[model samples]
Target: MFLAWNEIKRNKLKFSLIIGVLVMISYLLFLLSGLASGLMNMNREGIDKWQADAIVLNKDANQTVEQSLFNKEDVSNSLKKQTTLKQSGVIISNGTHEENALLFGVTDKSFLVPKMIEGKKFHKDNEVIADESLKDKGFKLGDKLSLSQSDEKLKIVGFSESAKYNASPVLFSNNNTIQKLNPSLSSDKTNAVVVKDANWQKKSLPNNLEAIKIENFIKNLPGYQAQNLTLNFMIIFLLVISATVIGIFLYVITLQKTNLFGVLKAQGFTNGYLAKVVLSQTFIIALIGTLIGLILTIITSAFLPSVVPIKFSIVTLTIYGVVLIAVSLIGSLFSILTIRKVDPLKAIG
Candidate 1:
């Protein structure tokens, strides 16, 4: 470690360049990771709020809530405890601005009802709870929103944060409101049934219903699986490419120090001690660079536009940082092998 510190200090420019490369790679990775998480949140954050173990959709709906609809009889009989939900996309306007909203028709006692960040829950047929994003578009508690292209009106009674479906803000209301908005829907039908526990088996469900694990349900959501796959592949590719680049850079620099290492060995330093210096230097550089990169990411997140989708998870970032450092150490092993092969007398003579 002492030799490692001395070498870094004596060759500040070279080590600094290595650290700079690491920071850039780490920054890019963190940014991509954050975006992937955020996009997923945009697609399915509303479902996550339910915290349900699984959902039952019509086997014929092809795992899509939009295409699934069934009467409440079987779900009520098959599961002792469950919540039924009816969802549809509707255009809403605050009289001045129009936007698409995924309207959910949930009973007051249903677990699908999220706690409000402001105001009270919807208890009346026409009262509603909307995602907080609506506030940016001139919405306020008690404001009346009209179902665009129709005469139906709903009053916003509350706001919930990050409640979205299919990248659109979610609106919560009673079945009556949704029924009033879309009279084509049958009175007793629900698009999905949510179960709080994973107790029920697939064979036990109604002949028309299929049980879908929460993860599978989310992944099956239209466009979500593809988006997640693409971003994940990019993130993986970035890590591999960055690791290789770092390894090659370190390998070249180590080769440059062949004479110095040979001199140290001639003075009676053991290969084990020399190997420790190489690893210690790698760890230090990776740690410092990763930390700086994380800081930059945090700062960059603060300045990002609201339109940008990103979520920074402390746990995720910490894991990535550890992986980067570990890989750096592993890469240094090649350099360690080089140190081991250095001929003391041949080089120093």
Candidate 2:
């Protein structure tokens, strides 16, 4: 181990170059991971906050919250237990204060409505809870904002953070509010229904209504699964690339030190001890690189708003750390093979 440390210290430039490559790869992996997770959050953050146990949609809707529609009466009749009305649609931008947004029309009983970051929830006529990011877009509490592609206006009553789906800020209002804007909408129905009961099963649901756990229901949302899969693939690809690069770098380092390892073997050092030395070095370098990259990610994320949709949970960090270390350890294994190949007789020459 002392010999390995001295070798590394003596070849500072070479060791530094190897560590530098690892750092760059680590940084790229971390950045890509953040972007992928961010994109997913932008698409599903609102639903995640709903706290609903189940979501009900029309069986024929084929994984689209937008396509599912159930009248207030249909939902009422379908409800064998606790349930709430939920309406959702994209907001298209026209001219004026009317901008593009995603609308979520819910009844007073809906759990999807976010708790206020400022004022109150929907109560009186024209009342709406809006995303805080929309305030700069010419919306304010007590001011009227029109939904684009429609002539009707809803009054903003409060503000919330993030509150988005499919990368658009979400606005919450009552079904009556949406009815006034979209006359073509069913006079009595909602986009979907969410339930908190645990006993819900698909076969037990009323005909034409499909019951799904909230997580499963989100997967059933149009484009949700595809988008998530694509982003996840990108993240996985980046991690793989990082591992390959680090492994190649370590392998080259090990190859260059083969003769030195032969000399060490001649001096009575066992292959096992030499392997530990190389493995320890690889781990130390990887740990430093990962820590630095993660710190940078957090700093960059701090400047971004909730609307940006990037979130790093403890679980994500733990998994990332585990994967990175595992990759580094794999890279270190190359040196072990090189250590085994050392011929003490060749060094005696």
Candidate 3:
């Protein structure tokens, strides 16, 4: 490690270039990860708040919540022995601003109710709880918003963060309010039922509804599976590319220093010591690069417009950082092998 540090200090420019490349790749990876998480949140943030284990939808709807419908009897019978919350969602335009939003009808005490960031929960028929993102749409506390298809208007009584469904901000209202807006749905009918028990799958379910795990339910959201798979592929590709880049760089650098390594071996240095130096150098470079990339990601996310969909999670970043270091170490293995194969006598001559 001491020799490794001395070598990097002596060849600052050469190592700096390698670190720069790593920083660029890591930055892109983190950014893409943030975008993927943000988009996912936009699509399912409201549902995520429920933290339910399973979602019950009509089997005939073919796994789509919007197409699934349930009658009051079905929901009542299903909830008799299990803890469940029923919710109905619809996408409609805000009558006053002409902006599209997702409206959800939820009971006040239901587990599906979002944590309020400000104001109070819905208590009256016309009162609604909205996503804080609606502030961008010019909605404020006590503002009246009419439903596009119905004469009923809702007053924004509370705001919650990250409350969205299917790329639209979510509004929480009473089931009665939703029935008023869409007369086609009866007051007892809801689009889906959220089951609270993790073992919900083992429990007997109503014949008319099927229990889908929460994770599976999220994947079934339109475009969610495809989008996530693409982003994940890109991230994996970048990781592999980064490893290749590091391996090639270190291998070439080791080749250039073959004579030096031979001389050191002749001077009684062990192969293990030389290999350690190479790995130490790789570790240092990876650490610096990951830190710089993380800092840059933080700065970039900070300056981004509020409307931009980018979410930074510490756990995700940490996992990426760990992978980067591990891959870098693996990349240096080729150089280590080269050091072990060095012929001391011939190279020194």
- Highest lDDT scorer: 1
Model 1 residue 266 lDDT score: 85
Q: What TM-score, to 2 decimals, does candidate 1 have?
A: 0.92
**How large is the C-alpha RMSD of every model relative to the true structure?**
2.1, 2.7, 2.6
Residue 59 in candidate 1 has what lDDT? 94
Identify the superior model by lDDT, candidate 2 or candidate 3.
3
Task: Look at candidate 3 and tell me the lDDT of residue 289.
Answer: 96
Question: In model 1, where is the ten-residue run with the lowest total lDDT?
Answer: 197-206
Q: What does candidate 3's lDDT look like per residue over 206-232, in tens digits?
A: 788898888888888889988899999
Off by over 4 Å in 1: 136-138
lDDT score for residue 8 of model 1: 91
Ranking by TM-score: 1, 3, 2
Each candidate structure's TM-score, on Cα atoms with residue i matched to residue i, is: 0.92, 0.88, 0.89
What is the C-alpha local distance difference test score of candidate 3? 0.83
How far off is residue 209 in model 1, in Å? 1.5
Given candidate 1, what's the lDDT at residue 330?
A: 78
